[model samples]
Target: MPADPESGQGPAAADPAQQQQQQQQQQQQQQHADGRPAADKPIKRYRRTELEEEEAKKKLLLLEEEGDEQYEEYVPRKKRREADEAVLMRLQGLAGPAAPEGDDDTGSEIDDEDEEQQQQQPASKAARPASVPQQRGKESLLVQTARAKKEAPPESATDKVLAEEADMMRHITQKQALRAAKELATDTVYTRSMSTGWKPPAEARGWSARKAQALREQFHISVAGDNVPPPLPSFALMKLPPPIASLLQQKGIKRPTPIQIQGIPAALAGRDIIGISFTGSGKTLVYSLPLICIAVQDEMMMPLEGGEGPLGLIVCPSRELANQTVEVITQYTDALKAGGFPELRVMLCIGGIDMRAQMDMLKRGVHIVVATPGRLKDLLTKRRMNLDICRYLALDEADRMVDLGFEEEMREILSFFKSQRQTLMFSATMPAKIKTFAESALVDPIEVNVGRAGAANLDVIQEVEYVKEEDKLAYLLDCLQKTAPPVLVFAENKRDVDAIHEALLLQGVDVVAVHGDRDQLERLEAIRDFKGGKADVLVASDVASKGLDFPGVQHVINYDMPEEIENYVHRIGRTGRSGKTGIATTFINSRQCSESILLDLKHLLKEAKQRVPQFLTALHDPLEEMEALAALSGIKGCAYCGGLGHRIADCPKLRSESKAQERSKKDYFGSGGFGGEM
Candidate 1:
């Protein structure tokens, strides 16, 4: 026989006609019944090989096994049963009333039947379309339950109790809020009404404005604000208590200084005041007398209980000043007690002292507290003391405090006061910035200025000398001989203070030194010895320049001119105290002192009617004409730093502070700092 073509064997399989016929038959079988040609159907372009298909089937089986294992591990039969029961109970609760007992039994029987059917089926049955309707029915039930819960009434006793408790807590919170608001409003109203309630004395009421102006002019006093009280003539005219008046007489203070003359009456009238006067002009007594009187009155009304007081707070800038203020107040307190008034206690709070001792004093109930800002803030922050009953607040050397970086602390302390209180700020020099600060901190304050603010004391004789740097030590002896014992020497730095102290000691002169580096006890001892007349000379840095009252100092020598004119004013003020005249000798070095400061010094000397040195007069200043114009316009000196040679924009202190702030920011933010890539 010939080659069999149907078997696709031998040479017949290679024939094109035979293959075409077979293809035609296969196409006919694949054609649609509507007579559409097979060519219209999509052709499969790629097909998996046998090995690829086998690998896919194996992957499918392995995935099925893994899914079964995970489902069994994640949801055991017992856990699934428990979860189903919990969900059913929740749905029933949301659906409203509980299900009947027979219905619960029927539901459990149905669940058991379904579980039995699932166990009899293969694992692949989980993916069958038969379960989709069951899942949809469960979702519809959940929706119905949520709708029912929204319409249901809250009738359970537990929910009613919780609602009542919530309402009670809300009511209590609202009550507390209202009480706090009422107290705040009362404080505000009282503070605002004080100015209207204040009145002048009978003698002061009758005086004409022209007469008052004449008195102020006669004493070189400057007053600002409305309803100012007239200046009393003497301590006796002040209407002080008999004990205080007698005490003043005993201390030989029959007459009040210009500051005391005006400040006392205003304070007695319960007016807040910003008292500006030269150093050694009885600024301390201005506040002290009022504080003592107020404290005494409080004590008489009701004796302080343990941890109950300080009725009055005096904030000083330095430890030495705080100690001195305590002494001054103690003297008046002792007099009050001797006169049969209630006993009052004064305590000192400062750094470098035992905090335990201060705490002990507080426990005993101190009526008056004289403190530095740092220590006082520490006590207040730690809750060791409180200002709840403190009604009188006085800031001595406020400008100095602000300069020493205590402005923030002062504001924080003010926040501790629970109610309106009397606030008084006294300083030798009140810069424009400090004046602005006082305006915000004090309420309707009266500004009592003894003279042009930052002006030198006229009672002191200022003598300026030019000395070569090398010959200063030898010429220091000549300046010392110009005055007697109890002289103060001020230097700009600690090293200079030590050098001068040693030189004086080697010369067999009784001298003591004080600087910031010295221990507190040593510094206090030095000051004590100088005040006691055991030391003829005291060499110190600018630490001694502010608010330190060294009585009977015949002379003050500036071993080095300070960088700022404010320091100079305070240094010279150490002398010329208590209506007594003294001498202030300053040595100027052309190389060490800046021309700006020298120009300021020259202007100050001219303003005080003192003789200006020839060198200072001959020195040419570019800002001289501008300064004159400013003075004519009633604007004098740098308002920021009290320098006559520059304005606030050009203030050195402000520039330095700004630079320091920027440096700190850079340090905190890393080398690239803020606004740069890390």
Candidate 2:
């Protein structure tokens, strides 16, 4: 073995005798070949006192005497019985009392053992394992800390009531709920008890024991079904659960309306229905109840996988009506939810808003859909909604919906529903076309007519005045002065509505106008302002006639007669609702008093037991008068000025007016119909 240059004294130091001498010198110096002292090797410093070292030694010795290996034995040494008593006594001194005798002795012993071990260990032994007794002590301390806290007491009665009221307030918006609350609080006559001694007509009252005979002769409630349920005498007697009954009572609906009394039972029996009731006859609830009941019943079945399709579909003719129906359904849905029913989802689908938002809402499951025909069809076409699971369907204002060019849309929507559904058609007037549609649509429906089909409200004091077209605005202004507002005035067209609205506004009469031409937001605001009493009069076209239920309407003025005779019934229906009396004045002109209009008005008035005007009665037969007028005017004529002798091209009055306007323009411009002063 030769030493290399890199190893300075390696070969020489390998000698046994010489290596011994060098190691002894290295030990004396306590130095390595690198000149770093061996004594300076990393020595950790600890600040433990002498007493802690002695205690740790004693613990080790105790472990050895007990025949426990420190590495293998995980369990801690038990504390002496006297030491445990001393620890308990100390705890009692701090707590001011000893623990109850019923306390677990094992838990106390474990805790004492844990405390003694913790006190015995030195702080330097940071790598020591946690003992069973230490863990037990921690868990017990946690339990004691938890037991020290107390639960909050139940809310007081007053506080509970207030919280419930707050929840109710949050359930519906303040504006909407307050409006309905005001209407109910101020007007109790409409919903008063039926037991009040004020008897209805013998024909209207069907309380006799002759079951089948009474349904037909008395009350005029006709049903053509195998097993139709009889009309319930009151809301409380219906098959409604107790919660619904209480909710109805809370809303102050003690007695059922004639329509509700007749329609609810038939609908709940799962039979189709054709309910012809006036507006504000509580028709919304008549169909709403059965639909809700059906939905609740179906809820017991297995839920639909892709979320629930509409269980009930209510088709409204107009967006306003659709939204109103949604509001009514939402109120009841909230009541059902409060009564521990499943969260029933409801959605309103209409146009003139975000279609994407509506689609999103529909894509998420909805239990009920209150929709206008156009919007509903749009969603169906887009594949964003389905109605195959629908078991209940209601067509509100079916007549008007059919007439509003929505028949195709409505038919398409109806086709989407299953054949097993219960169909309900609610119309103010049942025209032949409506009857035909219902016959094909419903399955042996029960036809319930509250009054005559085309009859006006008997509570409405209707009057007719022969006012010319030019004088209609003034006559309406006078009527506004004579009657109590808020008044709803109907015109034939949007132009007429705008003209009347402008006139009223110029005269400083707070007024609003609503028509098909206005955007949906504008229409909604106009209605809100009118309903909130910010506007004294609402000037609108026939759009407001059909399904809108405007409470507190003191008068309805027909500024322009509706083209269809059935519309006259619906227009007058706006007032005199819910047994409250109102006035309806029709401003008729000679042109409006044509035989058909006059005859229909007379018939409607007479059917409603109102005094028909003699002038209207005296009008000649419309068909005969049309023939006579045609014979008198042999040539094509201008209907605007009633030019019987010539066409509008040859009419003297029209030509003269046009020539005068041209001459005035020429004179204002001096010569060339332009300002020629300079």
* Best-matching candidate per lDDT: 1
- Cα error, residue 584 of model 1, in Å, equals 1.1
- Cα RMSD, model 2: 31.0
- List model 2 lDDT by residue over 53-81, tens digit each: 55667877888899878434222233233
At residue 622, what lDDT does model 1 achieve? 58
lDDT digits (tens) for residues 48-111 of candidate 1: 2333445656766787877744422233343355466456545555322232355222333333
- Model 2 CA lDDT for position 147: 64
Candidate 2 positional error at 669, Å: 50
TM per candidate: 0.70, 0.60
**Collision count for each candidate, in order:** 0, 0
> Model 2 compared with the native: what TM-score?
0.60
